[model samples]
Target: MTSAPPTTEPWAAPHARGPVQAAVSLPGSKSLTNRALVLAALAEGPSVVRRALRSRDTLLMAGALTALGARVETATDDWTVEPAPLVGGGSVDCGLAGTVTRFVPPVAGLADGPVAFDGDPGMRTRPVGEVLTALRALGVRIDGDRLPFTVHGTGSLRGGRVVLDASGSSQFVSALLLAGARFEEGLDLLHDGKALPSQPHIDMTVAMLRGHGVEVDDGEPARWRVAPGPILAVDQSIEPDLSNAAAFLALAATTGGRVTVRDWPAQTTQAGDAIRDLLGRMGCSVLRDELGLTVTGSDRIKGIDVDLHEVGELTPVVAALCALADGPSYLRGIAHIRGHETDRIAALATELRGLGADVTELADGLELRPATLHGGLFRSYADHRMAHAAAVLGSAVEGVRVDDVAATSKTFPDFPAVWSALLDAR
Candidate 1:
């Protein structure tokens, strides 16, 4: 929320003239950083999150926690979180961050006053009603069903069994589970509707909760149980954001170059980890070695038909890659992305068509047919992922200008610099 003022002019994206060879070290995962911050805020004692991502979204999360009574000390990428009594009567700027909007309310419910939550004008459309309504069902006094809402915390939430459809977003489930152990009677959460998107994120919530000594039973599908207990504080190291890596990797895939992202974990619950498989299917040579994970592009990029429901965040970059492919692609199982930072499906479809590609919008996804692309002004729509996608396309197509490049700060604040460095290394 403290980002610098945006430029009035569009940024002319740097084109990759040849094979790009570089080792890119990305910042920590925004998802993990925010989740760790929330858990540390509610833990039994102070905790440390090492190499945390210091981007706009994560900073907004830190600010929100501070407003809720947690003492967070930061130096570089390390954060020392000191737990304090959760109070109320404050305001939180959700700032177009899904994590901030969806995850903070449960923590706010344990506070002592009215914690008003609002976000950017765009956040008004993102789904938050399910989480708020679920809080009410669990005997918490909450006003309003979406962003620009308020949670009247009475120092405790009378948590018990609650069933709601989490088909729109998995954050609703993770949000409740993050603070469920602190509830008076704990929480029993069940999803009664369609399958959830981003299942790995919910898994991550459960894993982190267990690491903090909270007993969470997710053995059954669509059901999560958190037993009332004390949350233990622990020092932690976060993995690199694989989602952001997808954009850089896509550069290699599009230009027949080689890009390696350092510190790619051997195993992860991050939904972004699917990028390895996704890029591999697009005819990129993927390998993991002592030098980290390297992707080498093929002479020709092939189109792919894949379901990206679980890794919907990667859709923009994938869609950009698809636009440059040799054939048609069908990206499905990501209708939920429509409710993201912006209507990503519509945005991607519109932008790609503007660049002379044949893109058809589907209810659940997009079908992209390869066409000769010409330079055009690509707008970022104030979505960080959209900015990344624009940059990826820019590397391949000359004269590709992106408006509001500063929007990349939502997660990777140094995206433009990092991208330039990668291309310069060639």
Candidate 2:
């Protein structure tokens, strides 16, 4: 097992005033990168992936593919994957990446060997039973309900109608879709009564599948039918992550400064675009150019009530921005956050309170009042999002210290360096 990275303390002095200009080549989307890795591993021949994210999440996915018999090599910014027949199956450690932990197992079900999937403590707690149950229905062998779980691949998986409960995370549904091509008859997926929280993420999954030459029939009420076929390999570039874009967007709101993010795609299915509308309602001047986006902070931000069901992952960042607003902000429709890398709702509330914000954790979401934030040491709880959220909030307050800054490696490995660049540009 690889050792976790060293922890660091992240502290930020309040920005006095300035316009921030930066041309950043943001890392590739971890979500897309992982999905592509899985699909490429399942493809027939060699596939070239350009500008693949090298962050911890994608690294775990790549390593898992290597464990599954795919030969992976890196050359400069591109990763070349030569798919091999699944010969030897062994244990795959997913580290702290929930995407890799949940999504990898289902793809492994199509292999010929018994693959044991496990992860870091955080990934172990995330629910994989939904995918496991679906795989079992498709004639795959699954052992137990928790990590260190084993999947005995049957070489061929049969397609069946499955009603998925995806409220917790969309990765389960995406995983099934990626592996659908190998199934004998393919799959027809139906969503349970619970509403799909992050529809855009699901859309992104489908889009990437299509790019990989897999055909999916997207129907109404969240029904999808994937045909069993070979996935055609192609050279593809991953788009900028909207989730990563949120932190910099919040920077503008926190400092009353102007910051621009370059190389951001104009069109994206990522749910994090909710930040634009959400921030606009919060009284920030957000402008998008052909190159990227520019957000100018307002002198006084006004809070608004909103539901973040589709963009639940952005809840913490939104809550942090709301703390600097003029009035109380109400955010709902994110009850599933409790099951993420950490109990995000409770963790955010605790850390925000530590920064002197009046925050209440509701069953589904949170209510935050605009209060002066005092910089103090904040805990990351070993969660990357928690660490990034605390660091972004710390930029708005004096003397803010974020413990375990290294946790950001899970998604953006160069978070501290990126934040430093943004600060320097200001």
Candidate 3:
């Protein structure tokens, strides 16, 4: 584990004012980067992935692929992968990336050796039973349904209908879909309840698979079918992360500054697009241009009552913004936040309470009142979103001390730097 430098200087609060202007570029999406890395590693020929996210999560995925016998090289915004038969018989440290821990194991099942998947303490607590059950149904030898688990692949997988209780993370379904081509009959997925959260992520998964020549048929809410086919090598560029864009948007809104993020695609399957509509409701002037998105700060942020089902990942950022709004904000449709890097709703509520905000955590979501924020020491719970949320709060309040600041490396390793740049631009 690399030691992150200490943030000895306390974050100073931004004075509430009017239109600040800046241009910012966020790291590529960890979701897209890891998925592309896995696909590239499984391809028949050498492939180049451009603008890959260089965060800890994506790096862990890349390391896992390399350990499984893929030769990967990186050169300034590009990654070249040379596929070789997976050596199989090795233990893979997935770090704290749930995506890598859950998604890579199924793919590793196609290798010739026993692959043991493990991660940080938090990753071990996250449930992988749904994926394990599905893999077991397909004849993979899985010792347990939890992390620190071992899988021995048989070089070929038998695919069939698998009933998955994805809970909220779409990576489980995505993992199976991405590796479906290597199966004899492909994969069929069945949902047990109201389907998983972040459904758009699943759509993104299907879209990426189709781009590589694999076909998946959507048969309704719970049923999905994938046809066996060979994945052709193709050069692909990942879209700029909409999730990371939220923090800057919030910064603009809170400080009454105008911030623009470059290279953001207008039409994206990501759930973070809900930020645009949500920001509009908060009285921010939002403009979508050919190059990217511009959000101008409002005189006063307004509270909103809405369900953030699709854009659940942005819940923490939005909720933090709500703490500075004019009235009480109620956010619903995020019961799954409890299962993320931390019990986000509870953690956010607790932290906000420490900052003197009238925040309450419900069974499904949270209700926060607009109040004067005071700075204090903030704990991140080692969750990346928590760290970012704390930073946003710090921007709005003085003397905010954030512990575990380095936790941002999980997604945006350069978060502190990017945040500093945004501040400097102001």
Candidate 4:
């Protein structure tokens, strides 16, 4: 995959001239779309994924599956996935997506040939060894324990009882679980790690597996049992990306305006679903109605003490809101975010500090103390969420230009145009 867009010039983030009002219709959930792609590609028959995200990450996932012999047709309408006898002897470009690198290897193990996986230079540094090592212990022949590794697919995996620490990422657990039922012996996986982050994501995986007719017994914490069975083909409908919506919702919160995200689900395992309660705690009036989920900003944004362990992906945007809050805020239980696209805690602290907020980077999270802010250039470090943090702050703090705004294309390729339309609707 191509490296993130060049960063020779900074994009001038639109500063809100007044209280903005608009309805923002976001795209499908990257989380759901990627997961659906994997499950559908391993199902007994052809399956459909409605409203699947067409961004870099989801496309990379489709490409990876296709490389492993699955027939995935990406259309202007919807994506159709047809399962094929997985035979490898192909290469996978994971780009900078954690989902692709973390989720594809186990599936590759079930293929018949060798599959090599690699990605951007920075992705090489991301944490992927745990899952890779686990695969090795499960009788898959793997060349390395990280990105830039090769999985020698043997047309089958003897998947049963493997234990590992999943503290670094929930993706490791979800990855193993997604492909577990396909293993000849199925899988009895156990996590012998510290508290798992993003439990909801694992729940989403389990729920989706069951929806596809696979038996997943996650009754006990940190342990999962997948029975060997055929995954039934079903058309899956993905919800709007609530994590991406957090950026827009933050725009409303900081500018004391109103913003609505269309088609917010009543229930979901997406970690982004935590935005409703979290935004509400931060002094935004969150309402779910026929129109969808709406956030009406109060006169003053409130600081909050929240533990985002299960919803760590929302940290960047939430931290941006905290930087503009009316009081000190402590965001805890998300140290795992540091291993994300960038060192998220450090990135947030530095950028918010550059914008004149009193920020402290903790070993596990961040502590933001409200302060007067001014405009300046914010570096995205080629991270989509970091670019998002800058945009949220720029809406209120004038002249906050963001470098490599194109990094948002990792998920939302139309972020700039859609954001501009939302503001211009005022």
- My TM-score estimates for the predictions, one after another, are 0.98, 0.95, 0.95, 0.98
Q: What is candidate 1's CA lDDT for residue 22?
A: 79
Off by over 4 Å in 2: 1-6, 9-23
Candidate 4 residues 1-426, lDDT tens each?
123455558888888888889887889999999999999999999989998988999999999999999999997648999999998889999999999999999999999989999998879888999998899999888998677899999999988999989999999999999999999899999999799999999999999999999999998889999999898999988899889999998877988899988888887788897899988998889999888999999888899999999999999999999989989999999989888988888888888899899998899999988799999988887899999999998888889998889999989999988887766666
TM-score of 4: 0.98
Q: How well is each residue in 1-426 modelled by candidate 2, as lDDT tens digits?
A: 112343654545344345454546578888777888888888878888888988888888888989888988865568989888774368788887878778877778877889988878767777778888888877788998778789998766787688778877777788788888777888888768577777888898899888878889996677888888888887778777778888887887777777777776788877777788887898889888886888888777788799988888888788878887889999999887888888888888888898899989899989998788888877777877777787677777668877778888887888887887777767
Which residue window of length 10 is worst by lDDT in model 1?
1-10
The CA lDDT of each predicted structure is 0.91, 0.80, 0.81, 0.90
Report the C-alpha displacement of residue 106, candidate 4, in angstroms. Answer: 0.5
Off by over 4 Å in 3: 1-19
lDDT of 1 at 157: 82
Clashing pairs in model 3, backbone N/Cα/C closer than 3 A: 20-257, 20-258
- Give the residue spans of candidate 4 off by over 4 A: 1-5
lDDT score, candidate 1: 0.91
lDDT of 1 by residue, 1-426 (tens): 122235558888899889988788999999999999999999999999999999999999999999999999876678999999999989999998999999999899899999999998888888899999998888778878887999999898889999989999999899999999999899999999987999999999999999999999999989999999899999999999989899988888878999999989988889999999988999999998876789999888889999998999999999999999999999999999998888889989998899998999999999999899999988888888988999999999999998889898999889888887777777
Give the least accurate 10-residue stretch of model 3, judged by summed lDDT.
1-10
Tens digits of lDDT, candidate 3, 1-426: 122344444434343333457888888888788888888888878888899888888888888999889988875688888888887888899887888887888788888888888888777776678888889988899887777899998777888778878766777788888888877888888877654788888888888888888888985775778888787787888888888789878888878888888887878877777788899999898899986898888789999999887668898899888998998999998988777777788888888899989898898899988788888877777788877788787777777777777888888988887786667667
> What does the lDDT read for residue 343 in candidate 3?
78
Clash pairs of candidate 2? none
Total clashes for model 1: 0
lDDT for residue 35 in candidate 2, whole number 0-100? 80
Worst 10 residues of 2 by lDDT: 1-10
